[model samples]
Target chain A: MKFSVILDALPYLLEAAVTTIWVSLLGVLLGQVIGVVVCVARQSGGRAADMAGGVYVSFFRGVPLLIQLLLIYYMLPLIGIDVPPLVASIAALGLASGAYVSEIYRGALNAVPHGQSEAALALGFPGRSIWTRILLPQAFRISVPALVNELILLLKASSLISVVGVAELTRTSQTISASNYRPLEIYLAAGVIYLAINGALALFGTLVERRLQQA
Target chain B: MLDLSLLVQYGPSLLRGFGITILCWGAGCLIGMVLGFVLMLLRQLPVKPLRWVIRVYIEVIRGTPFLIQLFLLYSGGPSIGLRLEATTAGILGLGIYGSAYFAEIFRAGYQAVPKGQVEAALSLGMSYGSILKRVIVPAMLVSTIPAIVNMMAILTKETVVLSIITVPELMYEMQTMAAETFATFETILGMALFYWLLVEVVSRLGRRLEARVTRYLTHASPQGSSSETATARA
Candidate 1:
């Protein structure tokens, strides 16, 4: 293994690694927002609203995230709206991640028990206040693990944006390998970087899980 | 942004690409099944080194991203003196990626099977192959069918990535036509709709397969009479 080449490539890869993390953060944040709306709509919604949310989730969850990325990055330009790589990546990732996160939120919301919502409603509180204070706090606690999983997946799926020339960690490694013919080493290093990112995420997830449990 | 004229222009091209996507997905899923079963068997083997190989395969595949894997296979393969056709490389990469996934799903299915059933088979004079083929494989298929079906949906969508390697799949076709016509909106929106439709059909098929697998496993009458000869006959 060419340790020196990997060392040389690290500086380049690190910048792309930052882009990966940034995109993942933006995607996960957007996904969580969409997820909440979807979960709430599906749970306390009329038939039409519920179906709308359900269909959104089904479409996003059923397809592969990679294709979704490709569709976003490359296909939009066909119609004269050329989105930058980062924008397209985030939009695609968020849409897909939101579907999964909504499921997690749905499970969490359900775990809050009917009695809780009933108690809030029965107390003569406004419906918005009841859902925000009484139900959401409880739901967030239960869905932590699932949300972490979605985030991890988003991180990996971010690598796919390389197809659109978003110079993320994988692309940087590919560039290095192409120049030097040490793919096994370069790729392995890229894998380690991912492992580090994901490992940190997992640790954070576990800590959050513990905090939720203590609550 | 959408009108009938745009639809008419791109519809046939997108549909044709959809067919190619389905073809690649079908081939990839089938190859994945064979590779997954072989890997699972390797992992389950009594030998220690063979087991390590399986562990390594699973770890490397699951840990890395598919995009990177594709890059390695497509770009790196030639450098290694293994000149592969682009489509062949795509299919192989898809198979490799899907196999790691399928192995995990099948392993879960195997774990779900009752230990008592395996013991009952062993109590009789059933050979390993017969016991596995009759009892284990069928039982594993029950849970695995649903997971496999779900994987098929994912695989269908993933075929779009093959476009990067010039596979002429729907996504690639859409890209070319979009770039060619400067009608980005028409091409991508059309492609997305086709992809959505394709996945919807696969999901329906998957649900049906899953239902059938579960139904058959749950209610199929025992063919091998009683425990005494159950293993032997199996």
Candidate 2:
């Protein structure tokens, strides 16, 4: 609540903001890539691959992202695959969001008229061309709104990574609270920062949703 | 540490926390549904000022992260005169946060109800309460069940966050075990698996309930395109 303390802390908080943004962006980006691949695989592949992809989506979608963070943060290191706190957070979020994004993508794919796929094949478009040029492009458009929702969810989910001691906005505020013994102001500041980030993401989502609609 | 004793020892703690998780989720879901329905009803109220207040309540809760709201209630509510218990705060936070989503669900459910059906009920001179309780509620239930199920999954996960405020939930128990045993991987992995099992069971039940309701409707009434079934199917 102290303006002076927030001002004094602004620079440090900005640094933490970088981590938050990076983790969110990285997680969302990675999730989208994995999601698209999984959905495509689920649509076209053998029963085994489809089942595997289904399991991946179901498990991640069913559980809380916080528990996933704990597992990724703690369990990965035991298998001799140590990652930095930021990396672990990103990977865990990537896996969780990927599950959600795949569902969105699959839904969008369902929306694309089946005739379009048949048309591309009748026109002798290569398999890759048929998918990339004909199917996926249109499917991506239907998915824009859901994708935005997932992205915003990722931004919020990033807050959980602070528990594993990543110096993100939440952790930074916790650190400041401990140092200054002012839990209220610091927590409030962190909340404001989260609100600001989420505001930006939501606005961007709305803009994209509008653009997609116009298209 | 790598055997039956681990199960026999920590098993009780995990089981105890399981009960708390169920309590938190069950109570929170029920409260959220009732609160959400009431909020939805308020949306239909003719009183402008009261409706506006409820509208703002829905927006603010929906817009911000639920974690901050939980923290705000836990820390700031007590700072005033609330003196709420941690579990109580958790339940209230989860319920209120969820009600926003549920309000939207209810709103959509109401909108999706067949207008002609309402007209029919009105022509029969049925009171508003009876119409709602008998007709609209059944129809809305069909459309709203899927959304309620989806939100249920999200709420189940959110209960994990209350551990930070010391709710003695599953997540906190896992954190405790990790700290004491240094078997962080095992404890965390076990915790995640426990969460997976709880949600998977719920998801299966939701799907089954959804299918059963739709089947019962089509078989009993031969209705064309069930409204509640569609909503719940969402």
Candidate 3:
């Protein structure tokens, strides 16, 4: 294996890795927003909202993210809602991540003892404040590890967005491989970049978890 | 706005595609289960270096995207003169990729088996394989249902990635049909439904299996307060 090929490709691959990060970060943020809303709705005591949230989770979790991306990228154009490749990619990822995030939030929220809520209710605390003060904080603490897992999974999944021709790390590596005919080297370099990114995320997650435990 | 006629036109091919998808997933699941069990057992060995090697293998496989792994296995194979058919590569890639996760699940399940039980079996002069076969395996199977089911769902969704390697699975067939007929939305939606139903079936099977196992255990030990049955009942 020629080392120079990897070095020459490293800069370009890193640039695309930035795109991968950007896309995944946006997806994670958007997914969190969707998750928080869906989680709240599912527990909010409204039948329609709860049912809608259930359907959302089931459908998203059931379907593959690749098909989601393809549908968003292709179908939206026909409906006159033309989304750029990157936008479609982010939207697909965000939507799919939302389902998993909602489940994580649900598990975390359930972990917060029911007695705490009942105690707050007996104390005549308002519902919103009970949630804000007693429930969400505890749920957030419980959710940090799973939230980090979701983030790492999303980062890895961003590779699939390349199917829509968004030139992320995988796509960039594929491009270089095509040009240089060095699939082994280019692919290995891309894998290293992915491992490095995910490794850092895992470390950060552990640090945050430690701090949370300390608090 | 999907054309119903297009569905009628492509139903046979699409059904064939679905069959291929199930074939690949089933084959991959078998390989994953066997390999994952081996990895889990290897993890139990007292050798520190061997355990570390297995740990690294699991981490690396779990850390990267399956798409990259597929490419490396399928496309990179020719570079090493180990060229495999697309279907073979797909099955192998999914199995190898899935073994890391399955190994973790199996390890967790194995750990959930009470240590005392294994010790008791040893004191009774039961051989290692016999103890594992009679005690550890059954207990772990019951404990690992949820994790195993979750992994099955994941592996099923991941089969779509095989399309990248030109495996003639559901997604690959749908992509080909879409390119040929330009019925993008219809074909994509149809494929989505196919996958949705496939996942639903797997989850239903998981629930049934869980119920069956729980029922069998409940019948065997009516007074047992084991948390496994407690959670299973709940």
DockQ of each: 0.43, 0.56, 0.79
lDDT of each: 0.79, 0.82, 0.88
Q: Quick one: best TM-score, which candidate?
A: 3
User: Which residue pairs in model 3 clash with each other?
Assistant: none
Provide interface RMSD per model, one decimal: 2.7, 1.9, 0.8
Top-scoring candidate (lDDT)? 3
Give the DockQ-based CAPRI class for model 3.
Answer: medium
Q: What is the lDDT of residue A90 in candidate 3?
A: 91
Model 2 Cα lDDT, one tens digit per residue, B92-150: 88899889989889998898878998899999999999999988888787767777787
Error of 2 at A4 (Å): 6.5
**In every candidate, how many clashes are there?**
7, 5, 0
Worst 10 residues of 2 chain B by lDDT: B225-234
lDDT of candidate model 2 versus the reference = 0.82
Candidate 1 vs candidate 2: the DockQ winner is 2
Question: Model 3, residue B18: what's the lDDT?
Answer: 79
Which of the two candidates, 1 or 2, achieves a greater TM-score against the reference?
2
Residue lDDT tens for model 2, A1-215: 45677777778887898888889999999998999899989988889989999999988987788888878787687779878888989999999999998899888988999999899899888888878898888888888877877877787778888888899887887788678755566666777777777778789988988887887
Native-to-model Cα distance after best TM-score fit, residue A37 in candidate 3, in Å: 0.9
iRMSD value for model 1: 2.7
